[model samples]
Target chain A: MKKINLLFVLTLGLIFSLSNATFKTQGYQVGDTAIDFSLKNIDGKMVSLQDFAQAKGFVIIFTCNHCPYAIANEDRIIALNKKYAAKGFPVIAINPNDPVAYPDDSYDNMKKRAQEKGFNFPYLLDDTQDIAKTYGATKTPHVYLLDKNRVVKYIGAIDDSPKDAKKAKTSHLANAIDALLAGKTIAVSTTAAIGCGIKWKK
Target chain B: MKKTFFLALLLGLLAQGAHSQTIQTIKIKDLVSHLQKNDDTLRVVNLWATWCAPCVKELPYFEQAHQHFKNQKVKIILTAIEDELPKVQAFAQKRKLQSTLLFLDEDNANDWIPQIEKNWQGEIPVTLFVKQGKREFHSGDFTAEELMTQIEQRLNVSKE
Candidate 1:
């Protein structure tokens, strides 16, 4: 019985270690201020997070070319950028996935995708993935919204749909952006992001 | 001789194409039918995609657990929701994914995603451990050891 007890204690310790192996991701709250970082855009131009923050607010989307969820929302993102850019709220899209594992999400493909899709905003690459790590971006299409003060206003899914746009019941990203633009508090500050998980380098 | 060799190569290519295994695309209907069989058989289903980095990283763990529990009445399925069928089939073949491979071809995932679990936020690498009516949905990656432990615990506690 003593031997069995020792074995159980050892097993419990092993389980705790295994479960904690994954890096702990940070969650963005409503009042948290977002830090700025420079990253290369699809056109090979250096774009800084502060460049967009000069305006009323910014839409920082953690996205990649490969994920179907990101691909599906391409149009919506473009539309949001075009619609809100004039209002001093432009989208600062970032590709956070490691390029080595996913060649499709590399800088070259990002440029191709941006040009092909006619993205109005700067589609940047988080080359070192530091920006993604800082923001704790875990999904391909995770979103982060900031107000004029550079405080994180929202962090969550683009919408409630991956395939069918008609069936989407919630527009978390949109609602947050609209509320910020209209000078109103966002109703939903955070929601669990859904999409292809970000591939991080070992 | 060159012409004959070229002809042989062409024939080989055609044969290979003909013998290619079809990626069984699972719809909601098929999933329901699969669940109906051996209602007592606990099912641990993982929804993933070939392009998803975390999903690809953690898939071998699930496969290992599936092999470990093969003797038991439990069933494990790994569904890849790649828009391109050929890519998924090629990936499965390359990885030799042993966990009853499935391709979810539905363009509208919201319809079926909720059907599997309402709490699911449409995240890949999400795991569903279900036995009879009891269900535990986890939305993240797990190591081989962690997954095995989870399988053992869930299976033991499964009432039905």
Candidate 2:
């Protein structure tokens, strides 16, 4: 009788835990052709994915004004844009979090952040969050690197560190860009990106 | 009459205790020991700020996960990374965060962020899944479903 009761309890426990199981969507995959989406930049001008397809490659990063990770990397991203833009590559920043939930990440604040940071790239806001959803971006500072053919070469982190740069173990994003620029295939195509999760519209 | 007065006083004390079951604010230094002692159980620690919109949006998912595993032995601690104590407290009050909510008391980001996750870039809404020293740090907002899957997967691995 006790054995039967134990089995019943264990079954009940398993059922309870499994009922709440949820999974993140697997959207874009490596080697998949990148999709095109139009989003308004901080200056209110609409930018599309196709705008940069003519380049040798492009760095697409989902970032916002309030996330410390994104804020800390603003300088690095800007530098990447300047260095790579002249070399047929550009960095595109997208704000995917809900602006209402975060007033600091609103369009006005994005513009302020861009101006204050002297961002050379187009800092766009995904108002409907469609772009972010399509990309399966779960956090601020999520990155996607695409080659000239618009195939995803890398889909993960900006770098290995969000806190102390001196101690980072890997420069995943930069290394990927370097490999692509030098006509070498990237080794680490995906990584578990760490940062502020996206604030989806409630 | 003396007995009645004592009974009334006892009831008042109980009421106070019930109404003031506020989450005790423990320093990060103290939290490590508590976590260590609670081994054999999964701990999902989220670093967020009440001011962070993405953090706020994903707060409910964490709360749901906590409730789902309440009877089990999992601990879901939502630690606010807000430096402003008053604001953190007020936000907690306003949002009615029911999980074990804590405010990271550390102010030196350069010193502390690395301690939490070497790759952490001082971002809010960062979550850590730890079980028996096996840890996974995900920097992004998650839906309730995604959070639960990760928790379940971690717990399964821990059990194994």
Candidate 3:
């Protein structure tokens, strides 16, 4: 009886510690090596981080069609990819919202929106929402800039302004990329832009 | 006869619409100062948006609590962030949101997110429940039963 009780307590302790460890590994921070995912693009193709073989890094943005903030930054995101895709940094947008909660965010709608908005980059679908969870994307238009080695060089907003891009005082994402190209340290790494929170799976 | 019934229904709908008041836009500093009262009442500040599905889903819970705990010194305020006023006004009328409505009149989320709570990463459907002696934060949706349990637990703790 005594031995059994002792074993039970030891097992409980291990379970508690393991659960705590799982909570601690919820998401990524700066300098963390990001895990690659194979999500479906709007083109009916499976796209992964490793697919960009010749690229230097990626600009992973969690955005959707419904969110106004995402819609506001749509043009800016396209411009980023157009200017930077050949420069070795390509933009990869992922829609993490569950279609059940938001029918507009369905894969079909994603394709339509991409076409309507004239997206220059791959707008992927995180059907499982695992990528968004692991990346710790809290809001729509959240950005994570990666380097050649897939290390998260910078994270957070695209610019200081979300409501008005042309009136933005500073372009944080662009500045970060410029510094990376120049082999210099990024000055302002993370910034927060007011945006619609990413719609989570129920 | 049918036209008269339709006119009556429209009048009733308009009467119902009168209950949906416009949300006040308050600065973060003003909001914080408003929430800074030293009274023993429990202030429940819910951070939400008009477009947030989860926030909309959980709104009824806060509304129900607002009614059930009215005499218990619990005040509920629904604060919207980054949404168009007209859209939110329509939604407010459609949903018949009973909790006091307000909009956080500030941009630069990084600047104000920390002001609301240091650990908050600008997620919607976050509730800040506080009494004079104790404070608790809850993130995501909550059922009315769960919300009441939490409030009761806090009230009990603060009493002790």
lDDT of 1 by residue, A58-131 (tens): 88998889887899889888988888888888898999887887899988999899889999889988888888
Q: Report per-candidate DockQ.
A: 0.23, 0.15, 0.26
Q: On DockQ, who's better, 1 or 2?
A: 1
Q: After superposing candidate 2, which stretches have Cα over 4 Å from the reference?
A: A1-21, B1-160
Ranking by TM-score: 3, 1, 2
Task: State residue A26's C-alpha deviation in candidate 3, in Å.
Answer: 3.0
lDDT of 1 by residue, B11-104 (tens): 9976654542346787777865554454567788788877677788888888788779999867788877745778888887777666777787
TM-score of 3: 0.82
Q: List the residue pairs that clash in candidate 3.
A: none
| Tens-digit per-residue lDDT, A1-202, candidate 2 | 9999999999999876554222344568888888877899877889976776568888999888987778878887898889888888889999998877678899999988889889999999899998887876767788889887778899777666654566567788888988988888788887654467677676
| Over 4 Å off, model 3 | A1-25, B1-24, B34-39, B84-98, B133-135
Tell me the interface RMSD of model 3, in angstroms. 4.2
Best by DockQ: 3
What local distance difference test score does each model get? 0.76, 0.75, 0.82
Better of 1 and 3 by DockQ: 3
